[model samples]
Every structure is written in C-alpha cells, then in structure tokens.
Target: MTDDKTLGVYDEKAGDYARLMDHDTIAPTALNKFLSALPERGTVLDLGCGPGSWARYMVKAGFRVDAIDASAGMVEKASAIEGLNVWQADFSDIQDVAKYDGIWANFSLLHARRAEMPAHLARLKTALRSDGRLHLGLKEGTGEARDSLGRFYTYYTVAEIRDLLARIGLSVSDLRTGADKGLDGTVAAWFTLTAHG
Candidate 1:
C-alpha cells in the first residue's frame, strides 16, 4: 500500500480506529522495563499517536505529552480531548530540536517505507535530548505488505531494527520479541525495543 492510500484509510476511519484502540489502560507489560527507566515528569512525544490513548495515559502520569499523527481526522479527534498537544504532521516532517525527554513510536513506525526509516531515525535522534529514551515497536517479519484493512506496513526482525538504530547513534537498552494479544482477539509476533540516544 502507498503512503497516500494508508493516510486516506486512516483519515476515513479515525473514529473507528480510535475506539478500537481505546483499551490501552496501563503501559503494556512488554514495555515495563523501558518505562521504568524514564525520569519522572519529563516531556514525551507520541509519534503517530493514533487515538491519543497513550498520550492520555502519559498525561495522567504527570508527564507533558505532545502527539503527532499523519491522519488529519485522527488529529481532529485527538485535539478535542483534554490534556493533549496534538499536531497533524507526517513523521519525516517533524522538526523538533532536542525537545522531548522520551519518544514513543509504538506500532506506528511500521508504516514507514524501509528506505525511509534510516533518515527518519536520524531525524528522531536529532529531535531528542541527549540520552533520551526511545521506545519503538515493530512486527517480526521479512517484507512489506498491506493488512486486511488495506493499510501499508513494513516488517523487520530485531537485528534489522538494532542495525538501523545503531546507524543513527542510538543504542538498545532492552529488546524483546514474542507474540502479543491484540484487539479483536488477534495474536501477532512483535518486537519491542527500548533504545537511548
């Protein structure tokens, strides 16, 4: 699937997708080891913050939260919610400079085209404060494909993720791979990595 098509898919279904993802209450346990390392009350940026649920969680936790999503409809929905600084923008267009203390990409970066990832990683590194925490998640697999919903996705093994992060001067602090329960009773092999800039 192309980027345009994927963004349009999201824009068209922002409300449905937001409701579908509203169940994220606590941080997923797979992310606990990484979350434990963050300094208290620090600023966090949520990239591709689909429904802003995670951002809302961070807000309740007392951290300042900024959210960005490529889907304008998603942004509209997210911005209406209290306690979120939401922006409508693509990942590659971000220009924040040494601003966030932590960055959460979740499953969002999987939509990135492979060749575009390195540059985006570099941009993310530049956007962070020194040694800022980065939590990223991607599916464990071999190639790009569209999902049943016709959204674009790219898969990567843990090694590929590590190499890309290392190339941009980030080092993994903790990494894990396994099946995770998803919405709609689905299970998927996911790689969760916490890295530092």
Candidate 2:
C-alpha cells in the first residue's frame, strides 16, 4: 500500500484529478484498440483507475472491469458510478496472481519510483492470465516527484520501459510514441505499449 501521507495527497485532489483527464476521447480510443486486438472479451482490470472513468467505459463496452486506486476519495467517486467495482488498494499491495485477461495502466505506472518499476511490472504480470494483454502509458523522460498540484509522477524512456517489460516476462508487441500538447502547454511524450505474457 502507499504510505498514509501519499494517499492523503490524492484524497485531497481526487475531484480535480478526475477533471484533468480527457477520458471521453482518449480512453475510448485506447480501449477500443486494445480490445480489438484481443481474441475475446474477458475480465479487465483498470490498474490505478483514478476516478474509474476508464472502468466505466470498459463496463459500457461489455467488458467486466474491476478497478483499484490508492486514494479513498477517488475510490468513493468511482464506487458511486453505476456498474463499476472499485477497490481502495495500492499497486504495491496487490497480491492476487494470474487472475485477469487484460490490464490497463494508462498514465498510472509513471508514479512508481524508477527503482521500483521492475518489481511492480512483475507484479502486474503475475496478476495476468497467461495470454493476457497489457496496455501501458507513461511520460517520456527521467525523474520522479509530485507536481505542483500534489499529484505524483515519473517519466520514462522507451528503452527503459521496454527493458522492464522484458525482464518481467512480458513480450512487447507494439510501442509508439508521440507528442500530446495539453491546454497547460505541457508537451508530454506519450507512449502506448501492447504486451503479452
């Protein structure tokens, strides 16, 4: 589990945090692509599902979705959404293994410390079915810390992410990077990685 102090930061800003993401557009597109590649519909886990926007979308798309987040406020918000099964848990605290067909970790794993990424990636793999697909996104660069608004973040290079996946027994099927300019003038080097066990 995340420390009490870190969870407090997210709890304080869960609403603003939900407002920051463009889930209506970005989430559907990403999820559609991920689902299209799958052989069949299966249980999906929305890892670090902030306010459960993606989880809600997945449910609407006919996929069973279980979501988890560290913030109580975020969990509360997500739990209120009809048809979403949201849990209040941190990635580091996850112990279930080989239980999901797909895991969506959009822009969330970036918050993990760089040194802790490999182990976390392995944990994700352990939570997946043998043929499970993983869709991950992260900011491109190096460093770690909270932003001005108190949300934690970390950046990664393509090579670094690829290596982590490889070491954790996931084979990278696709990787792409591009610039996404947000309203705040932050040009994020975003990437989508498709991997399988």
Candidate 3:
C-alpha cells in the first residue's frame, strides 16, 4: 500500500495488531482448510503477512513460506519468527510467475486502492502454479473508506468480489462471511473466499 497514514499506523501499532490477531484466533478453520487443499510441503506466499501469524503457522506445518508486508514494524515482528522468509514490500512488488502452490492474502488486499485491486489480483494469479489455491479475506460492503484507525480500506460485496476474481481467472470454490471486532475496537462484517487459479 502507498498510503502513508495506514502504513504508519501499522508501523506504530505492530505489536498491538499482532497481539490482537494472536496465533490461535487468526482463523484456524479457514487456514487449515486452505492448507489441506495444498500439496504437502508446497511453497506458499503470505502476501501482506502482518506479524506473520499465519506464515509462522504454515512454516511449522512444514510449508516453505515467503511472507511480505508493507510496514517495516510488521516486517520486524514477522522476521523474528524462525523459519519464515519475510521482507518489507508493497502489493505492487509481487512479480513472480507460477511459483507458489498457494497464496494467503487474508485481510490485506483491502488496504489497497480500489483501482489497483485487479492488477494486484492478476499478479497473484500469475504467480500461482496450475490449480494453485488463493485464500482472500476482505471487509464485505461496497466502495472505499478509512477505518477508525486511519487505515484505508476498499470494500466489495460478495458478488462483486466473485466476479472480479472470475475476470482474473480465479475460480471460487468456497466462501464464508461474518462480523468481528478488529484492532480498532469496532465490529465489522467481512468475508473470506477460496479460489483456484
């Protein structure tokens, strides 16, 4: 993401964010399901991996994990996890082709601008091997806005997201939606979709 305010907030509150999304509470059901869909020991990319919670879990599960986040503070925290290869990078920096067996983009692409999502998703699709899986999490709604914490968000309804993914050549296989309290202390509706490239 290029938004300075959003990156700054995550930079300053990296620890708080990490603690809030603690290991066990970071959507284990969806995570484990995604893992089960992947080939054993398959390479994975934790795109926009904040605090590396998911990445760390995948590493422990024996996946080769490459994690990246835009916030330096987030990178610092994630880098500390043994066996995780992490770095500071924006969504636009993703350029690999047919390299990963799965891509975990939970709650991260929402930080991107609305106009940039298609290109970003395309890059992710291109980076995946045939039948590679992609797990995406996004706030469910329409349009874009800033959160209480000054972080930018681009929301999409289920249909909108499904169509977008289809246009990008990702076939949706599973979807789940719910409301949850985030680090900003307010409840928001969100959705997760599992797709294959």
Candidate 4:
C-alpha cells in the first residue's frame, strides 16, 4: 500500500518541489556524467523523475526513457514534456521485468521506509537488462521520517546503503557523500552504483 503521509507531504509540496529543483538546468550535468558510462541507445528508467528533466536529458542523448513518480502533479508535469514515457506510479509499485538497460533514480528512493528498501531494490533488479547499470542518489543519514517541511525522507549513512545494496545482489560501483548544492543546499549524502543482475 502507498504511504499516505509520504504522498501527502509531496502533494502539499508539489509546486515548491518544482521551483526548488529547477530540473531543466541542474539535472543535465549529473545526467551527462551518468550517461557517459552507459552503452549507447539503451533503455533507461528514471525513477521518481520529477518534471522529467533527467528523462528529457536521456531522450536527447538518444536513449529511450521511461519515467515514474508517485505525485500526480509531478507526473503530469513530466508527461507534458515532449518525448517522455511518464507514468504516475510509485517505485514500490513498479512491475517491469528485466526491461531496462539503465535505471537513474536521482534523489527519489529516499522517501521509502527503510524496511521497504529491499523489496524496492529487488524490483529494480528485476527491471534491469543484463549488464544494466543502476544509479541512485540519496541523502545520507540514518533512520527515516518527515522533515520540517512536512516532506517525508529516509536518510542513509554510506555504509548502511552499501550493505543494503550488496544484500540485494547489486554491486556497488561508486559511493560518495558530500553537501549537494541542491535541496536547499542541505549537506546531503549521494551515491552512484553500477549493478548487474
């Protein structure tokens, strides 16, 4: 079942979320860096793709991009973007089986409850093509809950995230933590992993 609290937080903050992300400009650099390491012309899934910025970048890069987000408002915004296959679905509800060459989950999975992460990771694994890569960016910390903005978040320490990934059969290719100049300039932990299933 969907987490009402989490959805409520995003629903309430949808408009501000767009303004804060400024996806069109800020996403390309990271997208390019992630895409640079992938095979050309392969399918990609942009998990929690708000406003489709990363998906747009992927499409422009000549890769097919399928994207999803829990917020109807966000999905509508993303669908309006040209050349994107945007769906209003939660990551936990995704059912694609071994269909993507890359999964770019930029700043999305952190909203999931810690206990639910394994199943979500398993689903992601099932959705990837052989030798496919998965890149995820999450705020670094321990435990989970709502923030002052009423936006739900689940933070992870690097070691906790790495251990969880390994348990789900994903090999950690890269892991780093630092203050991201986004999300209101909060000191956040970020991770990038290339996993094969």
**TM-score leader:** 3
Stretches off by above 4 angstroms in model 3 are: 23-26
Q: What's the TM-score of each model vs. the native? A: 0.89, 0.88, 0.98, 0.87
Residue 82 local lDDT, model 3: 98
Q: Which stretches of candidate 2 lie over 4 Å from their true place?
A: 1-6, 22-24, 181-185
**Top-lDDT candidate index:** 3
Better of 1 and 4 by TM-score: 1
Q: Listing every candidate in turn, what is its Cα RMSD in Å to the true structure after a full C-alpha superposition?
A: 2.3, 2.3, 1.0, 2.4
Worst 10 residues of 1 by lDDT: 24-33
Please give the lDDT score at residue 36 for candidate 1. 59
Q: Could you tell me the TM-score of candidate 3?
A: 0.98
Q: Write the per-residue lDDT of candidate 4 for residues 14-41, one digit (tens) a residue.
A: 6777777764353555577678877898
Higher-ranked by lDDT: 3 or 4: 3
Given candidate 4, what's the lDDT at residue 187?
48
Cα displacement (angstroms), candidate 4, residue 18, comes to: 2.4
How do these models rank on lDDT, best leading?
A: 3, 1, 2, 4
lDDT for each candidate structure:
0.80, 0.78, 0.93, 0.76
Better of 3 and 4 by TM-score: 3
The 10-residue segment with the lowest total lDDT in model 2: 180-189
Pairs that clash in candidate 2? none
Residue by residue across 35-89, what tens digits does model 2's lDDT show? 8765565788898898887888788878888899887898998998787778888
Output the better candidate (2/3) by lDDT. Answer: 3
- Pairs with steric clashes in candidate 4: 140-189, 141-156
